[model samples]
Target: MSQADNLIQRLFSRRAGSLLPLVLLGVLTGIIASLVMMSFLFLLNATLGGLNGKNLEDFEALTWHWQLGLPLAGSLLLILLYRLTPPACQSVGLAYVLERLQFGQGRIPAANIGFQFVAALIALGSGHSVGREGPTVHLGAGIASQIGQLSGRPPSQLRLLLGCGTAAAISAAFNTPLAGVLFAMEVVLMEYSLLGFAPIIAAAITASALTNGLLGTHAILEPVSLSLASYRELPGLLLTGLWVGLLAALFQRLVLVFIRLPLTSRAVRLLLAGAITGGLALVTPQILGSGYDTINLALSDGLPWPLLLGILAAKLLATAAAIGLGVPGGQIAPTLMLGVCAGSVAGALLPGASDPALYALLGMAAMMSAVLHAPLAAIATVLELSLSAEAMLPAMVVVLGANLLCQHGFHLPSLVITQLRVRGQELQTHPLRTALAQRYLSELADMSLVEWSGEGAPPRSKATALVVKRDQHYYLLNPAQLEQRMAPDTLDALLTPERRLQRLERDMSLLDALRTLQDDTGAGFLVPVRRGRGLVTRARLVHMLTEEGGLY
Candidate 1:
């Protein structure tokens, strides 16, 4: 290796050295993700402007025929695009990123990223009632994974980079850096620690700064002046939370049902979804695209109760169908829109409580928390976007009610986890396993012993463990076993089936190595360390458990 390569390797091999590089990487990830998301937004807006001479989200300006035709054409095009692409490259969005993190060692295909960029543009630009955040996440995580692979980092570090990218994407997309960090921890990483938190926070800040520099400091949602009028309004807020929780549950159930449908053909599914969205769009064009305008309207209390309910019903069906039918977009915006309408309706129904605007904000928090099973992140997003401290108590109450309803009453999993299950993959998380996976077997293997000779000779070294070779197989022999076998003078005794040697790679995680050791009762395992093959036994695990404080 070159001198620089050697220096980098040595630096990363140390814990302290690992931090600076990862933090720098996180910054780079944020900048790149922000640029990518900005480009996506520009392209989408430019396309929409060219087509309709209206704002990117103003599908309402489109003629009735165009509203119906755009999604239908886009669906047909998506079907053709999927057919042309490889099946491996067809997977996109948050669930795909999670699946790769779990089973693919944070390796995302470049083709999938490219496909998502195009597919999301088409889906959103054509008013498919899906949000762009999902594609932004896929693109961002893909970039980070690619960078990590190119850097030749270990799987553990690669996973961290993936989280960094995910946080960066959300930060840039919504201009909510805190929410980005929380989302990465709660939804993507599914765990949090000081080590992971630092880099993710760095990434979120970097991305948010870059996004603001390029796209200006405009929030994704309009800032609203709202608050609970009185403490007595708490009961009404709780009721709104329950209402949103039910809607969230129903939305999840609809999406899950569609995902699990017996239909196998992608084109057929897209066609059915397009038909549903088109039918809904004909009635209420606001249901098309991410419906941010609809949300703004609800927040202003501009839409009457009947109109708000109609939009809510249409958006719910359209978004559920779009997601269930495999549209390459996000559900974050849709959930926000749903929350706004639900909260507005509740506010209108409950007399003398608070402004409908406050209820809209609370509903947004509740739906997001319930559907995604990420209450902390949802609350963070609301606080960051609304910039209203007064909204916090009501948001918390609503979010808690929604969470309790979803978790206890409905027993529904998070949206991404549910999708993962439908794809036959289970998300695994354990504190010990997570800790051990960060450490390689080489770090814990016993390397003090010298190889053992035939029975007559004692081991040259004073090491407690000795490696004995018999018939091309290696076994770890303790001093007692060595003494016991000296009288027998038979190598065959040490070569019993239970005492057979097993091999482990130095780069393998301690957790994986320990799992292998547990599954097979061997004399010991031979780990190919940097210097040479080293002997590892149950004692190594004991050393790791005892020496590595806080691992559990």
Candidate 2:
């Protein structure tokens, strides 16, 4: 078939594929993920509750034997699971999303997910100070990919739906819909467009609805009503946010340090982490199971400074050790513990503070923002959890401050650092080469080969090319073109003087590039080498931009 016919067929096929079906699929994926995660969480909580041999709200003590055995046995199970799984599958959820989006749809190996689920259960049930959200995120996305592959969807769309499932998992886990949607868009997809938004939003909403239905309709954070003594206390909460940001940065750094440790045996590292968590649990049982109860106590003024500080230190070490040991788990809940402790201490120290619960809530946002380097997601989480406009302003201030500090000071994002470590990538001051490569050629090189008309000699009118915008107004090649031809020793041989050159800015979006191509005739025209740099012949230019040619 002719090129014209091929182009027409492809375009028509894309146009005919309805968006509604994808949206519905997203919703379905979200609902299913929500149900699955909720059921898992329920079972975990019920099992843990049964093991506790007492109520959840009360400060009940377990026998020394039980205390030591729970985390130890759980840790052993996690270590065994880690030992069995491959190194590439060690990175749990966020890494999976990033890889699938930037790379392509590939199975995460069924065994990996099974091991993760089992390990997460052991971690949470034994009180390893980890969250269930991370495992569920992997579970949702993995399941969605499997479904898509079975149903024969395109790899690209299937990966997109996988992101939708990830969003659903997070939303259901936290019961915070907006945060889940933003997380999927900002961190997972890394692109904000109408194409992705519809599916992601549908997924997030469906997840939230299903979770609320099962779990009895409660906000995620669920903070107590604080009776404000005075307006003067507001500044202290803001100050608390600053401290929380620093703590978040510290936590991120610690995780990076542990992950970077040169341990030859992954099994040994995991066993060591197991020992650490098991030992810590014996002293302070509160550090186990995501430490949600401990977080509540800290926020509610149940513990003094010394005890809170000890719990903070123990939890930090336990969490970092567990994740770095290569066991599958989420950092989100651990971060919540860090923030709660930080904010609680700040609230305790301040003079005549209105309410520390307010500060503790703000601290969560700040800490998470710093760790994730995603202020928008953190802020959305704060709003969804708090359900208060008054809370939004304070959350925004701390989250922004925390994110800025993390970017400037820490120099490592939590999830990305973990991913890089698992992949054995060197941590350097510069960005990854793959990320840099995407921007260089992909923005400009599209259908560039068709423009190459290998005629013996160019016609007079066609020889001196004309570059035009929409409606066909000619653009000039600037003096650089002339200089290249005049200089004998220069790289002028690489120049395509026979073709018209058009100026393209470095920051032009892909959509804009596509629109420009639609208006131009023949093969695609050349884009400028840089901002304000004029274009060259499409044939040589395309070759230069790509890896196939030596120029790259």
Compare the candidates by TM-score and give the number of the best one: 1
Cα lDDT listed for each candidate: 0.81, 0.63
lDDT for each residue of candidate 1 in 227-328, tens digit (9 for 90 to 100) = 889988888888889999999999999898788888999899998888889888999988988888778777764679888899989988899999998988
lDDT of 2 by residue, 172-252 (tens): 888877888887766655555566788888998899888888787754455555444566766665677667777776676
Best lDDT goes to which candidate? 1
Global fold similarity of model 2 (TM-score): 0.72
Worst 10-residue lDDT window, candidate 2: 450-459
Model 1 lowest lDDT segment of ten? 8-17
The per-prediction tally of clashing pairs is: 0, 2
